[model samples]
Target: MAFRDLAMAMVYFSQTLIGTVGNVLLLYHCSCLHFTKSKLRPTDLILKHLLVANSLVILFRGVPETMAAFGLKDFLSDLGCKLVLYVHRVGRGVSIGSTCLLSVFQVITISPRNSRWTDLKLTAPEYVSIISILCWILHMLLNTIVLMYVTDRRCHKNITYRKEFEYCSTIRQQKSRTILHAALLFLPDALCVGLMLWTSSSMISILYRHKLRMQHVRKTNFTQRSSPETKATKTIILLVSTFVCFYSLSSIFQALFTLYNNPDRFLVNVAAVVTGGYPTVSPFLLIKHFPCISNLTDCVRNKKTYNVKRIMQLS
Candidate 1:
């Protein structure tokens, strides 16, 4: 394999390992702890489901790309290509849907009773799972069209377009398909963005209210960290920030590609890097934010310190 391929393989392999291990640890931590014990106060069931979806994204998308980067494309026959791309798309869509629901739930939970979305907290969980399932189903249907376009055409005897290639379907057919994909993606994307903004605004209002109450209690400029609501707000804020960063980078790169006369492979790779980068970083960020993970790290550090101290005493 070429050096470029080796480098790409390394990147994918590293991302897969990091995402898988981080999310697995997070899932384990969430499972072991009582939901009430955590400041964030996520339902145990919801956390488990979210982690399962994240795990699917890493395993389905990350692992396949890693294998392809390593030049292991022989197994990627027509059927394999369809299966891989389909599962990856499904997983990606599910991630977006689940995260969006999580944001909306946070917003609704934090919103006052008089707020328009206050009732959503009651209905959100039930519908959120349905929405997630529907996301996977919708994307699966949309990308099945991809199977028609994706073919294993040989190039220079040992080269091809990375196991799958999008052929130019009839112009009408292609436009229709692209439009369908775009439309489905736009709804969720818009909802997620709007909910993120609303949730963030609501969180600010809640903080302000708390600030006012604290002032009456003679606390000056103090922030609220003791409440379960505040912690959940922080988690949603971080999740939204991660989504915005990745999605924004992807949009910028895509726009650049369309605006420029000829988008280079380097920029294309950059686009791919951004698109595939979120899963790699998200779990790590969650771990950093979660106190349980912080405790685990602290425990490890303390153990190391104790071992070193014992060695020093012996010496």
Candidate 2:
């Protein structure tokens, strides 16, 4: 294998490994919260959906990209290509939708008790399940278009196409059809991203106002630990910011690949990396906020301290 191919393989393998582990761990944590009859927050419910979507995105997209990086050819059959691409698109849509839901829900959760959104705040949790289900169903239906165009690379080896997905090749369509299909695919994602941006801005405004009020009341230079709402808002902001940044980079690379007659191999690899970046990094961002992880660490620390004290007394 060429050194570039080997290096790309290693990078993708690492990304897949880390993302899989993080998602699985966090999923297990969420499962524990559910099964243990713990008081599950609305955010927790949304997070469970996000983690599952992230896992799918990482596995379906990352594994194939990794294999392709290793210079694997004809590794997937025609059916395999369709299934992989379809699932990856659905997973990615769900991931974006779930993030948007999380942000909007947080904004509702933190709104003032007398605000116009009070009714929404009270009822948002109840609709999370329904909304999530609709998101899944919508994406699943929307991405069926993939099954029509995608085929095993071997089947299309002789045909020229503007886009290539390494293991899969798309059957080029008429310009009008391509534009219509592109619009169908882009609209839903654009809507979700727009909502996320609006909600994020609202959150920042709310946080700023709260901070100013606190400063006026305290009249002190020392910083106080933020309230739970503040902390949660900050986490969601960070998560959304990370997603937008990575998604933008991935979209740019994808656009270049589509427009260029013969895109460079390096562009494809970088796009894959950027595409998977949000999934690989999001779990770690959330893990820090999981109470169970913190509790687990504290238990281990106390156990170690107890063991050391016992040894010292015996000595």
lDDT of 1 at 110: 74
Task: Tell me the spans in candidate 1 whose CA falls farther than 4 Å from its real position.
Answer: 33-43, 73-75, 117-131, 155-173, 219-225, 254-264, 288-315
Per-residue lDDT of 17-133 in model 2, one digit per residue for the tens? 999999988887776665545678888889988999999999998999988888887799999999998998999999999999999999998888888889997788899999999
Error of 1 at 63 (Å): 2.5
Backbone clashes in each candidate structure, one number apiece? Answer: 0, 0
**Candidate 2 weakest ten by summed lDDT:** 294-303
| Superposed Cα deviation of residue 113, candidate 2 (Å) | 2.0
Compute each candidate's TM-score over C-alphas.
0.73, 0.90
What C-alpha lDDT does candidate 1 achieve relative to the native structure?
0.64
The candidate scoring highest on TM-score is 2
lDDT of 1 by residue, 215-284 (tens): 6665433543456677767777777788888978887886675355346646755665676677667677
